[model samples]
Target: RVRSASYGGTQMRYRLQAGATELHAAAPAMHAHAPGNEVTLALPPERLWILPVEQ
Candidate 1:
């Protein structure tokens, strides 16, 4: 489920969750989205990034 989002001119920030896993991701803004919406992502592996957080 999508919790929140910020859509800029050409990019967007999305907050989504599945079970106990939550993710914040950025992508090009081409469509409109809002809270409580379920989304399916088909990101290409070569264009995806997974950064590890250091605490």
Candidate 2:
């Protein structure tokens, strides 16, 4: 999952979770990160994509 705050605002921190995994994550402008199968985060106008992981 992904979430975002405006580029010009009180910058805050966020905690991301998936099952038992937790990530201390933040988006500075257009941050894009993909860490696993079917997960993507594009932020600062938060966008998310879950693409299939081909095996």
Candidate 3:
């Protein structure tokens, strides 16, 4: 869960990978993301929930 701060406005890029499979995602941070505002990151079901080991 991404808890955005008050008066937040920025672009966020996220990348997730497992083994040979990888996923890239981007979201537009809204300026109105203030107070109780939050952004939730949902992962794909096809990918297994494993630890990402960097080589």
Candidate 4:
């Protein structure tokens, strides 16, 4: 699953998850604009494990 949030004016945050496990996470640092209003961030992939939640 992928989730995204926009901070207005070309700022956004994205999170990726898979089956109760987080795959990648990233947040915008500052407002930046590219040639075609594109922003990119490099993030390392992290290993995630699913743990049972006690209710």
lDDT per residue, candidate 2, 4-54, as tens digits? 223334343445555676545555535543443234544553454445757
Q: How accurate is candidate 4 locally (lDDT)?
A: 0.45
lDDT of each: 0.83, 0.46, 0.46, 0.45
Candidate 1 lDDT tens digits, 1-55: 8888998779888988978988887768887678899988776899777888878
Strongest candidate by lDDT: 1
Top model number, TM-score: 1
Using lDDT, rank the candidates from best to worst: 1, 2, 3, 4
**What are the per-residue Cα lDDT tens digits for candidate 4 across 1-55?**
4544445444444454455854333345474233233234454446444568769
- My TM-score estimates for the predictions, one after another, are 0.75, 0.30, 0.27, 0.26
Clashes found in each candidate (C-alpha, N, C closer than 3 A): 0, 0, 0, 0
Kindly list the per-residue Cα lDDT of model 3 for residues 6-49, writing each as its tens digit. Answer: 22246554443444654444556542333333344466778546
Clashes of 3: 0
Runs of candidate 1 with Cα error greater than 4 angstroms are: none
